[model samples]
Target: MKDGLKQRLVAQARAEGFDACRLCRPWDVRHVPERLAAFLARGYHGQMGWLEERSQWRGAPEVLWPQARTVIMLGESYTPECDPLAGLEQKTSGNISVYARNRDYHDTVKKRLKRLARWLIDAAGGEVKVFVDTAPVPEKPLGQAAGLGWQGKHTNLVSRELGSWFFLGSVFTTLDIETDPAEVDHCGSCRACLDICPTKAFPAPYQLDARRCISYLTIEHKGPVAEELRPGLGNRIYGCDDCLAVCPWNKFAVAAREVKYHARADLVVPKLADLAGLDDAAFRERFSGSPIKRIGRDRFLRNVLYAIGNSGEGALCHVAQAHCEDADAAVADAARWAVLRLRRDANGLE
Candidate 1:
């Protein structure tokens, strides 16, 4: 009966829009505690202090919910239709990461998880809990344990089938489902992800320093970024996809099945001048259902100012000067830096 149920669960997961569905025991990620400790010890997490606060539950899924007998890891594909790196060349436009081009994945993935969990409860008597990156659950390690994919050198999961373009979600249940064999690493000395990093965020293979990562700086971080790292930011205003975009395995990736993951017309190449003009209300309205909204206007403007500074377009100096006295200290500092950089560029100070 459990075997039959597992088969149907896989079918249901596919029907619910998940590209991969596999199961594992809750305690499968044994190496996580040591690795996570090392990452935190080295201060690699940067401003994401919440990672340190929930160490116990994050390190051990068994302790997060002791009654769970199976962990079902799900992967939803959000592959892009075009090269994500193309926008970096558009100096006057703000480049957003491919994943945030449309609606927030958390809201979309969680709703699917709830429906799948309900179906499981109806088919078999068991309690279930769903997580879509909102909890202390170690989804990536658990995904590898469930045979979904190996965690690549970039520290994000990579599937031979899905490439590096999928989001992970999980359902933890009390039913004793059979677990799949863990996936072995297939990175095999490929350095594409490491070489493409503008900020050298990776110290070594399978390791990442979030402090120097543009995604961490533009999103998770607060205050003015370190000036030394500003030039590497380029025109990216929200998140960076350098490591993910350069993976050689992406040749196998297909276009996303969900239309909501596709790039929106305005977002594909948003003008830096237009973005810089957005006030708080305009910012909120513009990014209404998008993940970029979480950063707020002041922080978003700070990122935009940094991008303008790196653009080498003297024309944007006026935009930067307008924000020189912004109420937010970080934003003001970023504006001043941008003005100086643009003026220096105009004076041939390179």
Candidate 2:
């Protein structure tokens, strides 16, 4: 009976736009506690204090909700239609991460998760709870346990079918659904993802030091970035995709079917001059439905100024100069740094 229900659940998930759906027991990710401990002990999470604060719940799904018998992990592909790395060469344009170039995944994925959860409760007579990235749930580990994909060397879920470009969502239910076998690492002898990282975020294969990760630095980080790492940020203003785009597995990556995940024309490779000029109101209005809005104008401008600093275009130096006295300390710091770099470059000094 549960098997039939699981089959229908997978079908319903596909109908609702999920690229992959598989089930696993809530306790399937038994290694999470120790791994989470090691990561936190090393201070790899950076400014994401929530990860440390909710360590117990994040490491143990069973402990998070003891009543959950099955965890249905779903993957929604958001693969870029064009080369994600191409924008890096256009130094005058800011390279927004492919994921943030469109609608916010949190809203889009959660709506699907909620609909799937409601269907499960109606069909199987079980209480259900759903989560996207906002939750403390170890969605990637659960995705691996459910055979949705293996956590590749870059520490992001990579599937044989969907490759490296997908979002994870999960539905935890009281129903005792049969589980899928976990995926094993297929990344043997491949270091493509690690080799491409501009900031060298990976401390070793299969482990990430989020402190050096551009994604964490650009998005989660609150203040001015370390001077040494600023150069590695290059023209990446929002989030970096060097590791993900370099994955060989992405050769087989599934194209995102949802229009919402497609990159907007203006956001694909926006000019640094245009972005550096946006004030609070303009920034919010421009990024209304984008994940970039979460970072707010100050942080966003900080990133843009960093990009402007890296941009060798001396014409943009004045844009940085304009923000040198920004109300936000981080923005002012970034602006000063940008102006200094551009001045040094203009004078042919290192």
If scored against the real structure, what TM-score would every candidate get?
0.99, 0.99
Tens digit of lDDT per residue, candidate 1, span 152-188? Answer: 9999999988999999999999999888999999999
lDDT for each of the candidates? Answer: 0.94, 0.93
After superposition, which runs of candidate 2 have C-alpha atoms over 4 Å from their true positions?
A: none
lDDT of 2: 0.93
Query: Candidate 1: which stretches are off by over 4 Å?
Result: 1-3
Model 1 scores a C-alpha lDDT of 0.94
Q: What digit string (tens of lDDT, one per residue) describes model 2 on residues 114-168?
A: 9998988888787999999888899999999999999999999999999899999
Clashing pairs in 1: none
RMSD of each: 0.7, 0.9
